[model samples]
Structures are given as structure tokens and as C-alpha cells.
Target chain A: MERDDIIEYSLHAHHSAEEGVKIRKKIYFVTALLSIITIVEVVVGVFISRSANEFANPGLWTSIKIGYIALTLIKAGYIVLVFMHLGEERKHFKWMILAPYIMFLLYLIFIALYEAVAVGHGMTL
Target chain B: MSGEASKTIESKVLWGGKVSPFSISYGKMMMWIFLVSDALTFGGLLVALGFARHAAVTAGEFWPSSEQVFTHFPFTHAHLPLLYVAFMTFILIISSVTMVLAVEAGHRMDKKKVAFWLALTVVGGLIFLGSQVWEWSTFIAGPDGDITTWADNATLKQNFFLPTGEMVDGAAKLGQEGPHAYAMFFFFITGFHGFHVFTGVLFNFIILMNVLGGTYEKRGHYEMVEKVGLYWHFIDLVWVFVFTFYYLV
Candidate 1:
């Protein structure tokens, strides 16, 4: 019996050579994008550390930190959407998978920040 | 059976008992559910880390910076901040790409290509795991040279010395202080992430074996690769969060 005769499910759509090339291109694009973001993050990190008294300006440091977080989130989003094949999923399915997590993450962050501040204050007193 | 009763049953049991409400395969949907729960577990750990760091900082104690703690790279005594971690992150992201490629190949029923990409993905995972091991060892052993303080009782503290042999601030003690708290959280958070990476590597190896054995070929679909790919990407995604929360922040 042929190897192809026993299989039952079609998890992926049929693709042509052009589609294959497109997929490979997408993979390269994702890799390059993630690498660039990482480089930017490292450069920013090293730069801020090397600069004399950069931390003295709390505002500037906070902004840089926020930028670092934003970049990381972007990289993660790209990885999930493209590499994880979430982007190709149906709209409702994507929402079903993502919405609850996003809401919960926000809630957790709020609770953590609030409680941490309270703990900090209590420790000081 | 009456026509009305039969129609009602058919409507309720969609897709001939497959019952995929979201139109995804059972395996893929289950994988997504598992990933979501795993993500929440990571989230809880990270949030705890955040709270711990916040408490330490608010207490006006000395918190050891990430650069100070993670400066050592493999085979080099130089102090390169974030470089090794950056390499680890790149390796993981690249492995994600390779896993996607394997899925793509599977879509085409190209067994050879699928196996090749899966092998590369496994290699990438192994390299990442090895790097983590090296990192964990360096963390546990800490920097050389002990600094002693003469208090009521003489205590020996391991100071993290720079390549130039200069000790960082607040490096001498490790009991309920800022730096100590920082070290504890660092160990816990990164250790947890490293555990996931280890498991992911193991999972990739299992899937790779299946690929090489032509199990997928026999099954006529590479859905297994895609399922594992989802898991592998989740690991990379969690690392992105860990890298940000622990290292960059």
C-alpha cells in the first residue's frame, strides 16, 4: 500500500510552488524582523547603561523602558500571528483564543501593580 | 425516525459528530486551550516577580541590575551585557521559523523537506537548551571572590565582580535585602522559563523522531507538526515576555 493512502485529515490547504516560495519568504521576514528588534533592544540597553548618569533622569529612563516593552510585544505578536498560524485562523476563532487572555493579563497587571505598591508602602511603615 | 426529529439531531450534531464549533480540528483546539492555560501560569509567576521587585525597590534597598547578574558569556571572560541572552532569544526565534517551515512542508506532503526542517528546529532547540544550562551554572556559581563583612557574626558574601575585579554595589549580602530579593526572583522566574525551554526541546525531539520515522507520511498529513509548531511558538512567545519582564525591565 502507498504511504498516502492511509491518511485521513487535511490540516493544511494544498499549495503550489509559488505559495511555497511565499511561505518561505514569510519565514525569512519573521526571522529578520525578530532579529532586528532584538538588536535594537540590546543597543538601547547598552547605550542607556554606558551613558553617565542616564538613570538620573527618571522620566527618560521610564520612556526607554516602555519602548523596550513595546518592541518586545511587537516581536511576540508577529511570532504568534505568523509563525503560530494564528493570523490565518478565522476572525472569531482568533478572538476566541486571544480576547480572554488579553483581558486576564490586564487584570493581573493591575492587581500586581496595585498590590505591589501597597506592599511597598507597608514595608516602609 | 420522523423527519423533524432527524433534522433536529443533524443540526445539533454538526459535521457528522466532529462537533468542531470553531471549525478547527480537535487536536489543534486542544493545543490552543493548553497553551492559554500555560500562558496564565507564566503570567502569574511573572506578576509575582514584579511584586517582589517592586517591594524591594520601594524599600530603597539595593536591587542588582540584570546587566550585573547576566554578564558572563560562554568561553569568554568579557562582560558583554545582554549579548548572550540576545543570542539565546535569536536561537529560539529562529527555531520558531524552522518549525513553521516544517509545517509548510507538511502542507505540501513533502516528507523530506518536513524532516529536514524539523531536524533543524531540533538543533536550534538543543543549542538554546545548552545555552540555558551554561547560563544557569554561571548564575548558581556566581562571580568569584568572597567578600567578608564583620558584623555581630562574620558573614561571607559572594560579590559579583566585574571583569576588572570591581564589585558592584550591594553585592556583599543575601538576606532579605534588595539584591537578595532580586536574586531569588531571578532564579525563580528564569528557572521556570528555562524549564519550559527544556520541555519544549524535549517535545521537539519527540516530534522530530516521528517525522523521521515517516509516521506523518503514513498519516497523510503533517497536522502533528503543525500542532507541535503551535506549542513551540508559544514557548518562544512566553520567552519574549520573560526576556522583557526579567531582563530588560
Candidate 2:
């Protein structure tokens, strides 16, 4: 009976066999897969920065900045959605966690860029 | 249904028993409440960062360029921008990973492994805090032989010229230089976050001692680690925004 109990505990812990196995494996696989996407973010950021430095033009520079922002947003979104398990949650829960944040972040970004750009009112781009 | 009611009554009595008065687990609930408060703290910091940026302290004169302020010795001394911040970001991400592993070990009830990972997380926190100190010192450069402080990029841009000619009145002529309110905000926000990390490491150290001494062994589970892990993760989450707004953005 002791040997049987040990086997049952091992299986339950390792597979979560008592709860189920497929969901656990899926979470594990998804986490490993998303790690590749994170590596892509670093690589893309470096590439954009390198190219911007090489060309050293205003238009190219703006594009590089956009790319950086977009890539960062992607990485952040993925981490929140997957690692934090916000994606698997109910829709209302998702909005409860993210909506206010989106609104607040937008407000901050608007203020930052607006003030930054408005610094020199009469100066030409 | 009757059996369920009896179990509920038993649980209520058990929870109300002496030596542990909480209905729910005290540690886990406290962690949640702490995280809620911490979220507000971070939100306020970000809002303050926005306010400072909106104040336009530099304006057209200096424009407060991050690239200029952060030039350092990592790649080359001539002029490297934002690289140090990127390194700091990497340090934080790695620390968060170690923290997750520590929590994982705790879940597995591996006391020694939990202690080892917690120590790693503490060391990572210390290293990151040390890097911030170095970053700050480099930012506030020393006076030269002629008593002229180094002209940072912000000053140069504010001057609207490459070479900042001279000081107007113990201040650089190139830009609207000198410490401002925004500087105060930066120091306060970063200092507060660093203090959290420092205190967090101390808290984890206490838990480590307790675990090592078999206090947790008698307690029947490693719930303390789970409680502290929540705080540590919240700290890491706040750093994510700090890196973006304060450094990258």
C-alpha cells in the first residue's frame, strides 16, 4: 500500500494526473515557444538600431523608433498575456486588468509626446 | 449537501482555533493586499514621470535627451547611448527569471533548493542596485581641473550648439541647465524602487534563515516563500515600466 501510494503521489505531482495532463503540457509548450519570440524582439531591436546608425537619416531614424516601440509593445503584451495568464482568463477579467492600464498609458504617452514636440513652437521639423 | 455543511462547519472551527485565527490563509491574503497597494505605488510613479515630461524643463533649449545623459564606457568612452540601460533591463529580466524559479522550488516543497534560488534572487537584486548607483554617479560628473563640469548632451542641445562655450553664472550657457523638479522626481522614484528591492532581499533573507533553521519544516509548508515571491514579482513588474519610461522611452 505504501509503494502504491508513492507511485500515485509521483504521478499526481509530475503529471498533475489527478487534475489532468494536457493543459499542463500545453502551458509548458507555449512558454517555451514564446521564449523564441522574446529572442526575436532583442534581435529586431538591435538590427533596427544598427541600421538607423548606419544610414543616419531622419526618416530612417523615425522608422527605427517606430519599429522599436512596436517590438517592445509586442514583447510586453506577450509576457502579460502568457506568463501572467491574462489571456486564458475570462474576457471581463482581461479588461478589468488591462483597460484602465491602456487608458492611463495612452494619456501618459500623449502628454509626453505632445509636450516634447511642442517644446519649440515656431521651429521647423 | 449535509456532508458539505458539516465540512464547512469543521473548517470554520479549525480556522477559528487558537494559534491561527485567520479563516483563509493569512500569508496568501496579505500578499494579495500588499500587491494591490504596490500597484497603486507604481501607477503613481508613472503618473509623476508623465507630469515631469509635460513640464518641459529642457524645452527647445536642452530637450532632455536620454541618449546624451547615458553615454558611458561599456562599448567605448567617446559616446555610447542607451546601452547601459539595455544592460540594466537584461539584468532585471534575468532576476525575474531566478525569482520565478525560486517560487517554483517552493511549490515543489524543496526547502534547500528554495533557499538556494532565493539567495540567487537576492544577489541579482544587489547587483542591479549596485549598477543603478554606478549609473547615478556617472550621471553626476565631477568638476574638471578648470572647475568646469562635463557638458552633457542635454546641455549641448539646449545650447543649440555642439561646443558649450562657457558657464554664464556657474551654469552652462548651452542650455537651461542645473537641477530641476524633474531631477527630484527621478531620484525619488528610482530611489523608492531601489529601496523596495533592498528591503525585499532582506525579507527573503529572513525567510531563508527560518527555512534553514527548520522553522518552516515545523510549519508544515513553504507558504512564506509564496508570500515573498508575490512581492518580489511585483517589484520586477514595476521595474519593467521604469525601464521603459525612465530609460528607453
Candidate 3:
């Protein structure tokens, strides 16, 4: 009975074939999509820099920043999902690993943006 | 089943079902855990780099536009955007493929094939390292004329201070900012990654020799292939992150 119970729990915890295949497909699709988006981001970052137009002024930089973040998130998502095998992991394990990271990242971002904005305001003065 | 056989089975089952320091081979499981920790370190560095970029850009420092900085041919003064990084990316990817092939050969117990594939992977790694060296030299040299040196190795201060106590402008100034902390980060990160590649090549070489000596053959299956493959793939995965964060971003 003890051995049977152990086997049952492990079988549940162990990575399954059906899930692996699905995750693999998802990874492939995400990689292709991310590659396309990366190309677009590089082109826009480079080409738009040369322009002296109004849309190129504040808007171009803003767009580039947003694009960079979006692309990074997609790449990170794929890395975690596929290479790290998080996609097929137990929901509790996933949360345990990533939740702290997500929280800390957001906190760091807030502090950085706040400092940067303050510095910019000071520079203006 | 016979009583002795049944007893033997019970003993096996009892021990096998439990997770113990001895039951789980510490070496292999530790490798996985170490790899995961290394991944987190890389992730954190990249995140910190992201934060730096965000803060600096918002603070009115003209981000060295990636296109303009990277645009260069060996001899001719021509601007080629995304060409160098793309070439480097392709080289790393090809090396990754060769690494996979080496792993396959190891699985088949083909020592010669594994050695050959691993050697190619090493060559590819060397080429990538050479390319990185050139990139770093160009970055530190600071254009054709201006000699900008960072005052101190401080992260807070922009390293590129002019002789006139001003930030180096676009035009080739007489005394420019020496390489800043950004350049330092670039060198350290890429240099560290290159060192991993170098060491990985050595690991493959050792494995090749072991295989030639009939070590794994005597032991049974080629599980070493799986172990090394994990390292090889981890290297490739790191490159993917580096290529994204360092170049495109």
C-alpha cells in the first residue's frame, strides 16, 4: 500500500508526455513570433532614430521603450515556459518560483522610475 | 513468488519509494539545481541591465544608439545595422546544433563522431570569443581619435568625461570619456559567457577521451551525454538572453 501510494503521487508529479508535446508546440510558435517581433523592434529602433520628424521626437522613444519591454516579456515567457519546463510544472511550484521574482521586479521598477523621474525634474530646474 | 524473492522485492520497494540523500544521486540532482541557480543569476543581471537602461534613458543620457555603434566593417567605413550581432547569433546557434550532434553521437557510443562534433563546437565557440574580443576593443577604443577614459570605476558616474570636464559629444573630441560602466558590464558579461564556452569545450574534450578509453561503455548507457547536453543547451539559452538584452534592446 505504501509503495503504491508513492508511485501514484510521483506519477502525478512527474512530467507527462501529452503535456510535453503541447508545451513543445507552444515554444516553437512563440519562438517564431518572437523572432518576427525582434526584427521589427530592431528596425524601428534603428530607422526611426534617423528621422527628424515630430512623431520621431518623444513618440519614437516611447514606442521603442514599450516595444523593448514587450519583446523582452515574450522572450522571458518562452524561456521560462519551454527551457525551464515551467509550463508543465505543478501550479504550486510555478507560483512558488515566479511569484517572488515578479513582485521584486515590480518593486525594483518602481524605485528606478521614481529616481529617474526625479533626476529628470532636477535636471530641468 | 517465493518468500525470499518477495522479501527482496519488499526491501527494494520500501527504499526506492522514499526520497533520501543516498536514494537520489546527489551529483546529478545537484547539477540540475546548480544550473537553475545559474539561470536565475543570469536573469537577475539582465533585469538589472534593463533597469540601468530605463533609468539612464529617462535621465536624458543619449543612449548609444545600437545601430550606429554596431555599424562597422573590418576595413571600409560603412554602416551596417544588426549585421554583426546577427552574425554572432547565427554562429552561436550553429555551435548549439553541433553540440546537440555531439550529444547524439555520445548516445550512439560513437566516440569518434562525438569528438569530431565537439571539436567543431569548440571552434565555433572560439570564433565567437574572437568576435567578442574585437567588439570590446572597438568599444573601448572610443571611435577613431577621441580617448575617453572613465575617471573611476563607479557605476553612478558616466565614465566618459572629457579633458575639458564635459561629457563627450558626438563629434570626435580631443579627450573623450573613457569606457564607462556600461562598457565594463558588456565586457564582464560577455567575457564570463565566453569563459563558460571555453570550459564547456574542455568538458567535451574530457568526455571524448573517457569514451575513447571505453569508460562509459563499461559503465553501460551513455548518461554523460544527457548531462553534458544540459550544460550545452544552458549555454545556448544564455546566449539567447544576451543577444536580446545586449544588442536588440
Candidate 4:
């Protein structure tokens, strides 16, 4: 069967050995970054919860949550860019993938802030 | 050469006729799009969680803080906070790395390495699924009790021991009506993610079989592996946010 449908990018693309090395290094770097971030988050969270005691003072929670989410977003960006190879993608394509998520994140942050303020006023939105 | 020809075509008209504007294949682009929508779905769930938590917190009702509950490790009775969940996060992250390695091997047309890395990925996914199972059982079993006086005592006693090392209100009410939404959202979000891991393992297994059978070798490419890799990475990415909202924050 002389079928010719698989017009993929350079089917037998045997990239240079150095290129493979670079890719592997990037993967390791991202892994290390993610691991460190997770550990830092846990340690900081547990320490603050015990020391400041968010249970006693809920005011600190909003600030703590902001830091946690920021770190988590950084880990997520590395996963998408390096592991998923979205960074290697075309310029416009990168934005195409990211813009929607960015907008959703803004909306989420807005809601979170609003809730924090509203709860203080004894209101639910 | 095709490269020279495409360079001219790219500059002339990216969206006209044959060239893919995004410079990605249909399947890969579709996978990316699907993942975006899936991310939104998860975002909606977390938003709902936030809404419930606020309502609960404002009412002075019981809301289980992450530091309070989820202290059980697989073995040993040390009151560790966020330790087990941190391990789970580590496992998922490692699996995502292996998946990237597999995809890289595919890029270089190295079938053997692809299979090897994919096998590791499948094992990692299985471990995560098993960990979730243990976690859920501990959650559902509640705290041990005779359950003679109270009907919902066992379930209620799930709040038996928090990491705070103190029980509020002394054997009754425990800060008003218990943490219902906390437990509910825990189940829904983690269960949904566990299901994704289960399916991911199944999918990776199928793809691994193809790799072993030399299907990709015959096809002269392994784009299928790359596509699966994208899905695997997406799962790990979702877990980061899940771990943040549920465990860390």
C-alpha cells in the first residue's frame, strides 16, 4: 500500500546530538525548578500556618494565598513552555494558546479579590 | 528544497491555502485547543470552591483548612502537614519529565528510548492513582468510633484530630455544622484529577504498545507519542494548580 497521508515534519528528524543534550538539560532544569517551588511552598505554608496561625487570624490568609498562587502559576508556565514545548512554537501561536488562559486568570484574580473584600463586609457576591 | 520553498511561502501568505497558520499539525493543534477548554473547566470548579469557602468562612461555619486535616502518611503516626500531598506533587512532576523525555526521543526518531521513557511514565501514573485511592479511603473511612450516641458521628469525627493538636467545642458541634463544602470539594476536584490520571495511564499504555510493535518505526514518525506527551504534561500542569488551591493555600 503506497499510502502518502503522513505529511508530518521531517519524519526521521534525527536532530543533532547537541540539540538532544540541550533539550534534556532544559527538562532537568524545569523539573528542578518545579520541585524547589513545591517544597518552598509547603514549607512556607506550614510554617506560616503554625506561626501566624491563619486559623486565628484569617486576614493573613489572603496574602498567603496570593503568594502560593503566584508560585504555582510559575511552575505551570514552565511545564507548558518547556515540557509541552509550547515555547518552541511560533510566535503568534504561543499567544493564541496563552491569551485565553491569561484572560481567565485575570477574571479569577478579580473574583478572588472581590470575595476577600466582600467577605469582610459580610456580603456574598 | 522544500525548506527554501516554504520560507518564501511563509513570508507571502501564512493563512492562504495549504500552509498551516499555526505551523502545527491538525492533531497537535486540536490537542492544545482541547487542553485550553479543559483548563477553563477546572478554573470554573475552583471558582465554585472559592465561592463556597467564602460563604462558609463568613458564616463562621467550619471550613477545614489544609493544615488542619490531611496529615496521614502511608505509614507512621507523625502529624505531618502537607507532606503526603507534596509527595504526590513530586510524583506527578517526575512523570511529566519522563513524558517530555519520551517526546524528545520521538523527535530524534529513537524508538527504544521512547518506549523506555513511556514505560516509566505509565508506572508513575499508576503510583499516583494508587496514592489517590489510599487518600480517598482514609477520607471516607472517617475517624474510628463506636457510633452509639450519634448517627453521623463517624463521618463527623473525621474532624477528630487536626494538626492544630486541639479539638474545639469539646466533642460537639466543632465550630458549627462541620466542614461540608471542604470535604465535598476535596472529593470532587481530586476525584476528577484521579480519573484523568487513570485515563492517561490507559492512553499511554496503548501508545506504548504501538511503540513496542514498531508501528511508529514503520510510519517513519512518532507524532502520536508527541500528542500523548502534550496530554500528559497538561495533566501535570492541572495538578500544580490543584495542589496549590487544595493543599498549599
Candidate 5:
């Protein structure tokens, strides 16, 4: 079937070669961004572990650990926003999909960490 | 009177005619719901991991450090920590990019470009699956020649030599209970993620077959490709969390 014959709702119409090229550039851009982030993560993982020594002073190590989590979250956000096309979604729809889950996850993590620490104390006592 | 009666009858019907409040197609909306639920499932597992690790720490048990554990790279015997997993992450991320491209091509009604990018996406997924398999085996086999006592015995040992030759109390040994708990959690979490990746590969393969068969061509729209792209991207997104919880953090 030809594009003209299709009777369906679509976000964009048929495009020329220039439009295709533009999309290709965007794809490469996303790829490059993800690649650089992954590289920075690996670099940090290797060097920070060597320099800080997670066992010696866990406090310093933890700050570095927080940095890793931040980077990972950033990467995750980018993938969800761009690759999943959630960024293109209507704002209300995006919030409807994302907000509850984010809040719930935060709650779960908090409860788990707190309870785990309490349990550890019990075991030690 | 006739017009008023007809309007009353229309309002009385069961279906709401056009109730897509989100302004998205039914399939896309359904995919979003599934993705949200799937994300929660992963969140639960990761939270459990955090609990386990924290408890081990509190009880003075040995919890294995991910950096020390995932140091093996492919081919060369030298320990290149996180390199292989980084490669796997890049493969998955690039595959996600290809999936977006396929969706864009679908928007343009460019069948050839859609098929081409979709094929590359599938290949990327396959490579990632293969890498995960290798990683699982290497993990199960234990890191490079029994570097720790836990390798020989599942029991957590208090003392193990770090890659830097510094001796430290392994998290498994803190409570004097051994590393079995740590190992079990590691296997279960990564195995679960791997299963998701496997299913994702299968999903992509089916979609690719349909694309090759020109099913979308006949339908006049490649919305099916877009739907599967949502799923593919979800799989990648889950891996981002898993990678952080399992390896990086």
C-alpha cells in the first residue's frame, strides 16, 4: 500500500531526504551521548576504587558511590526520555505514567534501607 | 422532537465513542501501562538487594563488591574491570538508538530504512544477550582462579585479598554466616535481568520477521514497530538500573 492510501492518525507526514538525514543525525547524537556516559562511568569505577579503597574509609567511598548513582540515574533518564519517546509525549500523559512509579520506588528504597539497618543491629546485638 | 430523541439515544449508548484521554493509540497506552508495572517489579528486586546488602553490613557479614567481582574482559586474560559489561551496556544503548531510528523511519513510511534499522537493533540485542550469557558463566565459575576463599566454599570468609593486595573482611563474613546469601542474591537478580533481555530479543525477532514479511507494508502503518520499540527501550532502561545496582554502585 502506498503512503497516500493509509488512512490512519500519524504524528508526522512523509518526509524528504533532508528530513531523513536530520533523523539520522539525531540517532547518532543519542548514541554518542550514551557512549560517553558509559565510558565516564567505567573510568570512575576503575580509578575511584583504586584511589579511595572502598574498605579503608567507607565515608569517602560513599560520596564516590553517590556520584556513580547520579550518573546512572542520568543515563536512565536520558534513555527513558529520548529513546522511549516519553519526552515527546504530552506533559500530562508523561506525568501520569512516570510520577507514581518514581514516588513508589523512592518509598520502597527508603523502607528497605532503614529496615535492613535495623535488622543488622538486631543481628549484631 | 426527532432530533432531540436521536441525541438522547446516542448519549444512552454504553461505549464512550472516543475516550482516549491520553491522546495516544490503544496499543501505545497499553504498552505504557505494562512498562510502568514492569518498572515496579524491578524496583522491588533492587530494593530487596539494598536491604540484603545493608543487613550484611550491619551484621558485619561479607558482601561482595561488584567491582572486584566483574573484572573480567573478553579475549585477553588481563583484568580490565567493567570493560566487558561497559561494552554490553553500549551495545544495548546503541540498539535503543537504532530502535528509535526505526520508529522515525516508520513515521516517514520508509519501509527499507525501517527494516534495515530494525535488523541492526535485533543484532545489537543478540550481541548483548550473548555477552550476558558469557558474564553469567564467568560469574558462576567465580572470578579468575579462586581469588577468594568463597570460590571454593560457599561459606563467607572473613579475609580475602583485594586486587590491590590489601586484606579486608568480605561482607559475607561480617556476621560469620558466609557468602551464600550474597551469591544467591547476585545470581537471582542478574538471572532475572538476563531473562528479560532474552524475552526482549525474542520480541524483537518476531517484529523483525513481520517487518520482513511486509505485514506493516500492507497495513499502511508501522505502528507495530513503534510498539515494539517501546518494549525494546524498556528492556534497556531496566538494564540501566540493574547495572547500577549490580555493578557500578
Candidate 6:
């Protein structure tokens, strides 16, 4: 594995050692980004569970909840754009693949939080 | 997946065809299509979980704090919150990175690197699946007996805690009243995601075998590895949302 001695038969495939190093660097960067976000999420999440009156401050609690979802979407985006190579696709095609998901996330976040708040306020529906 | 140069298309024949308009390989395109569809299905499941959560809220309970519920961390019971699930998230992310490396190796036709990364990926997937089993078991056998047993009780008691550190009947504190809707959603949503991880591990193992047997070597392409890599990444993607709705929020 140390040496790139394996046969590469595909057209336009196979990168030079430098190119491989660059790609690995990008992967490492994305890995770090994802890990840092998860750490922040867990730390804050645990802090909220421990701190006084988390639900007492509705505005702050709501922002923190939204922040969790935001960080989550960022993680999902990295996995899609970097790990799944959607970023390498054509521009229009990339959005063609992404529009539905973007819409889905919006719909989910809005409805779930809206319903939760409404119900917590004693709304029936 | 040839040259990245974007050539202009003639306006007159624009609608005629470029079945592969993106110039992506047929296999890769199909894999993307499958993943998009699969993503929607998983999204729908999460939405369903969201709706079910609201339904529980209507009944006066959404859920106990996830950290409190998911506190068990294998060996000791020192009461670490979100630690186990957070570690699981880390594992999935690492496995996803390995999957990317495996795909990169396949492109370079480096059989050894591909095998190494893919083997590590399979191990990661297995660990994740095993952890899911353990989590489900812990969830099932809750603070009291099995969570299912508590569902039948009009008022159930468990070691559920509020942020204030006050101990209360977990169900009463969670839902305030009603059948255990949280348990149902927990079973279905995570079970569905767990099933995906199961298939992902299976697919990764199968591809690892193909890589080992040099099937793609003779075929002159490692596109199969890319396809499975897409799937593996999708699993991690789905888990992000699952972790959000099911555990984090």
C-alpha cells in the first residue's frame, strides 16, 4: 500500500502521489470539521441538560435547539458534498439532487418545532 | 466520469438527449438516484417521528431528556449523558471518512489501500450495528423493567431526571399522561435506521470480498466500490438526522 504499484486501467482515473496527498488532506480537513461540530453539539447539549432553567429561557433554548439542527445539517452537508462526491458533480445536477432535500429539511424543521411549541402552549392540533 | 471540462450544448438539440447530461457514469448516476430516493424515505421516517413526537406533546409528554435515557456506557454507571451516542456518532463519521478513502484508493486502482480502507469500513459498520443493538437493549430494559412493560401502566415510574436534577416518574415527567408514544417512535425510527446500517455493513462486506477477489480488477473499473461508498455515506447522512430528532433534540 505504501507504493502505488497497483494497475490502474480506467480512463481518466488514478491520481499522482501528490494528488493523492492533496485529496487525503481535504478528507482530513472535512473529518476535523465534522468532529468539531459534533463535539460542540454534545457539549452544549449536555450543558443544557445540566444547567439551570434550560426551558425557563424559551428564546435561548429555542436558539440552542435550532443550533443543534444547524450543526446537524452542516454534518449532513459534509457527508454529502465530500464523502459522497456530490460536490464533484455538475452545478445544475447538484442542485437537482439537493433541492428536494433542502425543502425537506425546511419543512421538517418548521413543522416539528411549530407543532411542538403549539402543543406545549396547550393547542389541540 | 471523464474530463471535467464543460462544453457548451447546442440550443437547437437541447431537449433531444444527453441521457447522461451530467456526464456521470451510468453506474454512479444510478447510485445517486437510488441514494436520493433512499434519502427521501429516511427523511419521511424522520418526519414521521417528528409528527409522532408532536402527537406525544399533544398528550402532554414529548420525551425525557435523551442524555438521561441514554446514559449507560457499557462498563460503569457513572451517569454520563450523551457520551455513548456521541461516541457512536464519532465512529460513524470516521467510518464515513474511511469509505471516502476507499473510493479514492479504488480510483487509483491501489488494491491494497482499497482493501485496507474497506476492511476498516466494514469493521466500523459492524461496531456501529453492535452498538445499536446494545442501545436498543438498554432502551428496552429501561430503568425499571422493559420499557414495553411500563407502557401498560397508567402511571409509570423510572429514574427520569429533569435538568434541575429532580427525580420523577419518567413517563409522567415525559408525557404527563397517556400511552408511551416515545417508546413506539424510538423503536420504529431507530429500528429503521438500524436496518439501513445492517444492509450497509452487508453491502460493504460483499464489496470487500469483490475487492479481495479482484473482480473489479479484471473489470477494468472500481465503480462498484464507488456505488457502495455512496450508500455507506448515505447511512452516515441519515444517522445525522436520526441523531438530531431521536436523540439530540
DockQ leader: 1
Candidate 3: which stretches are off by over 4 Å? A1-65, A68-125, B1-28, B104-113, B142-179
All candidates: CA RMSD in angstroms?
5.7, 8.4, 8.4, 4.3, 6.0, 6.5
Q: Per-residue lDDT for B1-249 in model 3, tens only?
A: 743333332232233435323222333345556666776777667766665655555555544444444554456555565667766766765676666566555555566776787778778877887887766655555324233542332212322332234332343342343335566667777777877777776776777677677777665445565466557667766877786667665
Per-candidate DockQ versus the true complex?
0.49, 0.11, 0.15, 0.47, 0.45, 0.33
DockQ head-to-head 1 vs 6, winner: 1
Give the per-residue lDDT of model 1 (tens digit) for B164-248: 4433333334432235566677777778877887887788789889888989888767888888889889989988998887777
Native contacts recovered, each model: 0.60, 0.03, 0.10, 0.49, 0.68, 0.44
Candidate 5, overall lDDT? 0.75
Q: Provide the TM-score of chain B versus the true chain B for each model in turn.
A: 0.80, 0.76, 0.72, 0.85, 0.82, 0.81
CAPRI class of candidate 3 = incorrect
lDDT tens readout by residue for model 6, B22-79:
6566567678888888887777777766766665555565345556666768877567
TM-score for each candidate, following the candidate numbering: 0.85, 0.65, 0.65, 0.85, 0.85, 0.82
DockQ of 6: 0.33
Docking class of 4: acceptable
Candidate 1's displacement at residue B156, Å, is: 14
lDDT of 2 by residue, A14-74 (tens): 1123322454454455445445544554444444443234234657656655655665566
Instruction: Judging by lDDT, tell me the better candidate of 2 and 4.
Output: 4
The i-RMS of every model, in angstroms, reads: 3.6, 8.7, 7.4, 4.2, 4.5, 6.3
lDDT of 4: 0.77
Error of 3 at A18 (Å): 17
**Alpha-carbon error at B100 in model 4, in Å?**
0.5
Ranking by DockQ: 1, 4, 5, 6, 3, 2
Which portions of model 4 miss their true places by more than 4 Å? A1-14, A50-52, A55-62, A108-125, B1-17, B143-157, B160-177
**Pairs in clash, predicted candidate 2:** B61-B158, B62-B158, B159-B174
What is the docking quality class of candidate 2?
A: incorrect
